[model samples]
Target: MSELRTLYPVIEPYETGWLDVGDGHSIYYERVGTPGGTPAVFLHGGPGAGISENHRRQFDPARYDLTLFDQRGCGRSTPHAGLEANTTWHLVADIERLREKFGHEQWLVFGGSWGSTLALAYAETHPKRVSALILRGIYTVTRAEIDWYYRFGVSEMFPDKWERFLAPLKTPAERADPVRAYRALLTGTDETARLEAAKAWTIWEGETITLLPNPELTAPYHDGHYALAFARVENHYFYHDAWMEDGQLLRDAHKLAGIPGVIVHGRYDMPCPAKYAWALHKAWPDADFHLIEGAGHAYTEPGILDQLIRATDRFAG
Candidate 1:
């Protein structure tokens, strides 16, 4: 059997800066890898998770020019965790602005999890601007997807973690609808309540993303500052359904026709069911699809990461 792939050696960004994306939001962005190589953009998940150093290692630094940025309210973006004017469309526009700023006519778009959702939105909205696509852990943000993670599906699989997730919400109604419940606390006036709820919300995702418990992955979710932005921005987006119409991404799959693409998904992905990834593969038949065994939702999983790096390397040509 072939050896599993892993991240490229850690490399620092050659250039980094902040973009004033308006609506009182200043986005933090960085450029890495060869300047004149294949142009590509990396979209981080969580709609709130922001970018991390590991994200820069996914592509071959010698072959691809990559741009990664923190969306509206998360990471180093100003007004930390602010929700105003932040939506799926706002982010899509921000991507375009960055693309224009870089002067790339079109670039490969690579995203995983929620990043997959944004990539689809952006690519569909401006198909002419995408040279290729590489998506992983496919998520369309439909009601079923949201309910699976926050309400019923994953809850049944991880009852112990589910219990901890529910401990923050006291009422039957809140437990019944945790997304809205968390949103209320996250956006409410009570700072203490907000931070507490944030930890619960963030921890739930951190612990559950991997098939196995990974302290290194889950530890950051517990930090009060990180959790607040993660939970608040994530909840805000979820509560609003990412401002996307039902089944919008899938329905627009036709827009992806003729684009070079790859889909990498874990068979046992919890936050994002494998079914949706299968659905996307069916919708975009031209794209190569890999259903990895012994993996979960996180891009860091061995099988998933191997497939992801393979996809990027393949597209780097």
Candidate 2:
């Protein structure tokens, strides 16, 4: 963990705008760093979680031209907490649109957690448009991975938190199918019920993301609007398995064979776990893999942060 390198200095974007991707949806994106430097796009986690200033610090401003955006219904994008016309494929198309609009033939793709899932989906579908992939906290959205975090596996590890996560669901059937139950609550007509479910769901996610609990990080979910979007959008995608076939990313690994990649994962990741990263590396051995010893799923963890920044620096050339 001590071996991790320092991130490049904090820098602000010289250009920021909302790109109209059609369907009455616009994604907010920004361009930072050198005007003609190496082009890279930062994919944020959570189907609903938007970009942050911390996300921008990962790249060296002098060497890499960086792009960051809030997908669909989250962050600075208009029409908060919207679920309509938003899907995994929609986001992939948004990426292509951003790339073409930027006039870049290919860009270094950087993502973590759900962002990694999107990156792989985009790269595999349009392999020629990706110069390289730098992924952290790798998640392929496999049903087994979902079952592990939302259903059985992560619960066993955090029994106390798991119990709270299940408190909102009553009846054995709801317990048996928490995702379905939560989706019902999240999308239900009752405003209070939806907000309560959102808080609980978001808190559980916040608690398990790191080795030690961070209440401050999960505090934003208390906002009804943020909670609604984060939980609703996340569960919406998870409900359909992000519209992905089982093991789809790994099954399509051959499509990414020629593209260079760097897979970085925290050893103790609870939400997505490290095995997904391992599985990705197994199928695409050409990419370098790092299993940080003292880290959890959160990209902000010292070890994971170090590795992620290191990867961006490595690919900045």
Candidate 3:
């Protein structure tokens, strides 16, 4: 076995600003690492979970120029948690706009979890613009995948946590379709109901993302403000099935044909099952795949992060 890889170091963005992607959406973006180096973009998961400072350290700062941004309604993006004009496709276009803004003909794209879903969508839609891809905790957002996390599968694995997740919905019918139930509460005019639903939804994910209980990791999910956007936007995306046809991403895997890629997944991941990542590997046989043992969904998990850092390092050259 070789030594595990870790994040490079804490580095601040040399440039940062907001881009008005229209539709009342202005996404916050930042640039870090070497200027005019090998270009790359980082996509944060959650559909609602925005970028973090740690994300900037995933690549070799001296060798790659990386861009990280908040999606339509999350993070520092304006209209925080606003669901209008925010969908998988809207995010895809925002990525292209960012690439053009940076004047990069092509660049590496790195995403984890929901980020992986978006990366696949963007690469498939515009294959020629992607130089490489590094995906972790692959989540295709298929109906089965959605139900697994929100409805049934993970519910079995974390029964205690599942109960807390279920507490927000008081009835059997609402419980039967948690996504729909949560969406109603998240979008409802009652501020108290919205906040209650938000915390429940966000905390469920935070608690289950790791193999063991990680209070540090799960703490932020409790924040009323962050949870509101994280839950609302995330639930909104899942409720609509990300506006994607069933298994659409896997159906279009061939679009990644010539692009260099790496797929890293945790064997114990709960939010995203390893099976979908396996399916993606089979579909795009050209990409290297690693089923990391003893880890869960988060990119911070040691084994998953090791492979991710290695992929970025290898692609930097």
Candidate 4:
């Protein structure tokens, strides 16, 4: 555990580049760690968000070549929230583009939360191209999962926060369909009303992230861009039902079984509990399952660090 005592993982020089997938779409990505090292890619969560710098630290620079990227309409990617050519299919295309851009025979795919959904979708559609998967906090992104997130499960636990989130829905029709609830937030004509909606949306999301976010996160809520991008793409995903259904990944886990996989989940993760990983394991018994005992949905959970390191090390091996 001597490797664990550190403020930040050692970051080697990293490169940021933009890949054009044509049709006026480009993806922002960062390449780091050793040259010609085993290829390891990082996938960020948030269907409509930027990849955080801290997330890139989980991989060991001494061990593997690391790649981190913002999905279309996110992070350093251009036309943020334009949404003209952004979808799960577009994202899967971006993954393939990266594989060809880097000239890798196959690359390791690492993702968390919503990213896990994208990785699963990508691997399922392009099974022959993937080398391995390092997935954390499995989220299949089914309608059941989205309904649980927006309507029933987590909200039932955090009623007050849910009330605050639903406060903007002045009309019964709006409350009945979250799509209307989101339209009021994202497309409201009044700037003040837009800010109000952004506040509620951010609050609800922050609440899900291990209770209300700390002091640091609240400031971003005041800025419309974060909330706008978040509201835009999240609604896109929720409206489209996250593009996957029950047992979908399971139906094709065999294609990836020949490739390695490591699934890490927190037993206490309320947002997406460990049960999802257990289900995936039921399909691909060979996939490694690392259940974090005391951790919740938050990524800073110590078990996440350990399991992530183990996955990276496994790739090194």
Candidate 5:
């Protein structure tokens, strides 16, 4: 499979310090390219993590002004995963803060996986402020979505992996109570439990994202400090019904229906299935959807990443 794209020289990169959001929480971010270009904000996946250097390649820097940052408690962000100021609501607010800070009344929003969900939520909440969307690997964060990941999503190919993931839960009740199991592993002082949970969580996430048998080059963002924060915060939202009623997006698609969006989904993506994308496109019929055959959930997939970057560049241009 094709590897990741090399960072473009035209995409000038610069790091900014931090933005304090109170409660001892701060977010880190960086900007690239000329400010006068089309504004595009890159939202990296992982609720716990921040933007990656590779994320910069999503858009050709020369065409679009790029702004990428770690959310609160993510990479480069201060007070890693500080629970006091972490939530979907907090993240949405942070995006708004970035836009106001950069003086972009409207900008393109790009996201994948959980990032796609966040970008969609933000656009829905502030449709007038967003120019368009370039989303990949859409994840809905519903119980069905999580259930698909844990049980139905990749169990056939990764049965052993799933077994290990669910090994900690002895009974059906405990398995059903994934929230409790996840909470204990994250917050409990049990080192063995935490480590086991971390390994299981990371393995499932990593394995599901790719099928390439290869030398592991990049670190799974899920294994970092942001992973913990993302899991906890994501679980909080998932437990609370993702704060979206069944028809939340469908009910609100009209706000974003006329807005332009180029959506990319992998045919074999197990982490977040193609079904999610199909459903989303049905909700917003005008959005463009490109189904990449033979590709899975991993952004590193050979043709998928470059094609997505190309789409971003086109939009930015």
Candidate 6:
């Protein structure tokens, strides 16, 4: 039997600071590992979800010059949860700005979920700047993918949760388009309605994100601030389709042809079906693909984490 691959030891960043990216956005960034090492940047999931120190542990402290940053309106970045000028294009530009700020010619890009979407966009726009990619829970932010999770597809598997997710919508029209309905409440002026809608939206996600149900994670959604930002940002991006043309990422796969990369996906991932990963592999056959048999959407799942660690170890050079 193969031994389980674990994350490198917990390591603290030697440097941490904010990068002023203009437009009233100052991104929070940290550098871990040796001062001079293989350059790698961790692109966190959630077009709005931010980074944590645990993200820094994904790389070898001695071999990788790991950098992690909270994108606009996320984590420790200023103007918390501010969405102005925070489109996908802005994010791609931010990645480049970070690279230029750090003076690295090229660096490995590691991302998951929405991060995968941004990674693809960044690599396509600035191919020469990305040496490789390590994507997990692959999401292209296409209309079909968004519709699958939010509209009708995953509902079949979790009818109860879906019903609870829809409880906030009173009218048939609102129920007909949950995405738009939730978006209205999230962006509405009524703070109570917004927080209520945010809780309902977040609870539905927590319930379905994993193969086995864990209701406890939904507890965090009670914090109106966290719930508001997470739900609002996610809904905003999904509503706009991450501001990309239909099937744009798959159409742009040619740009990643020579870039060595790995796609780590859970076989039973509900938030993002495995077929998306399969489609990505078909488009970019050069990239290594691994399907963890007993995992779900979380990158920290045992099997998924092991595979991610292995991929990073392989690319540590």
TM-score of each: 0.99, 0.96, 0.99, 0.90, 0.89, 0.96
Candidate 2 backbone collisions, by pair = none
For residues 228-295, what per-residue lDDT tens digits would candidate 3 score against the true structure? 89999999999999999999999999889998899999999998998899999999987999999999
Residue 72, model 1: Cα distance from true site in angstroms: 0.8
Those runs of model 1 whose alpha carbons end farther than 4 Å from true positions after fitting are: none
Better candidate number, 1 or 6, judged by lDDT: 1
Model 2 CA lDDT for position 289: 95
lDDT of 5 by residue, 64-117 (tens): 788888877657787754556566777888999889998998999999888888
lDDT of 1 by residue, 28-109 (tens): 9999999989999999999799999999999999999999999988999887998999999999999999999999999999
Better-scoring candidate (lDDT), 4 or 5: 4
lDDT of 3: 0.94
At residue 148, candidate 4 shows an lDDT of: 76
Off by over 4 Å in 3: none
Kindly list the per-residue Cα lDDT of model 2 for residues 229-311, writing each as its tens digit. 88989999999999999999999999998898899899999988787799999998779998989888988788888878878
Angstrom error at residue 138, model 3:
0.6
Alpha-carbon lDDT of model 1: 0.94
Which segments of candidate 5 are over 4 A away from where they belong?
1-12, 170-172, 214-218, 221-227
lDDT of each: 0.94, 0.89, 0.94, 0.75, 0.74, 0.86
Clash pairs, candidate 3, are none
Instruction: Tell me how many clashing residue pairs each candidate has.
Output: 0, 0, 0, 0, 3, 0
Q: Can you list the residue pairs that collide in candidate 6?
A: none
